[model samples]
Target: MPTPILVIDKLHIGYGHKVVIRDLSLEIREGEFVALLGASGSGKSSVLRTLAGFHSVMSGRIVLEGRDIT
Candidate 1:
């Protein structure tokens, strides 16, 4: 198997004390196309925003190219 170019492992994200996402994990390899699918307020955007560094993670790690970016 190819090494993943992007990886989100056990991610926890929230606003204040309100937890929006908990224990989210995903992996994307090179040349792989992915999508986030969910209803509104289901933490889909939260995942993307968190991956993009737009929010603070309460716990866990966000790895990119084998480096922990969280």
Candidate 2:
């Protein structure tokens, strides 16, 4: 949407050797007001963790403010 300020492609997240979330992708436009809404265990916080680099991405790319986080 109108160009993205942030992007996630094929993101895979896991704890240790176990993969909990996989193949996630998202795009956030500049000034976009967004919410990570879902039921419990929907990987909403997992995505945020991956973006913040707290959780290592098994395979994927994360771009934020023109910088690649992964």
Candidate 3:
């Protein structure tokens, strides 16, 4: 299999002192379709926003195309 185009490893996202998402890891390869499904206030948007560089992650790594973006 080809290398993943995007990789999120041990991602930890939170607001202030409260963590919204913890240890979130994912890998998306070329031509792969991904989706985030969850209830309201489930940190779905937080994850997307972080991926879009909208928010800062508390701790973790965000890699894209073999480069670390976080």
For model 2, how big is the CA root-mean-square deviation?
A: 1.6
Candidate 1 vs. true structure, TM-score:
0.92
Q: What is the model-wide C-alpha lDDT for candidate 3?
A: 0.97
The reply for model 3, stretches above 4 Å from the true place, is none
| Cα TM-score per model | 0.92, 0.83, 0.97
lDDT-wise, the better of 1 and 2 is 1
Please give, for residues 28-62, the per-residue lDDT of candidate 1 as tens digits.
Answer: 99999898888889999888788888888999898
Tens digits of per-residue lDDT for model 3 on 19-53? 99999999999999999999999999999999999
The candidate that wins on lDDT is 3
Residue-by-residue lDDT tens digits, candidate 2, 10-48: 888888888878798888898779988888988888888
- How high is the lDDT of residue 53 in model 1? 84
Order of models, best lDDT first? 3, 1, 2
Candidate 3 has its poorest 10 consecutive residues by lDDT at 61-70
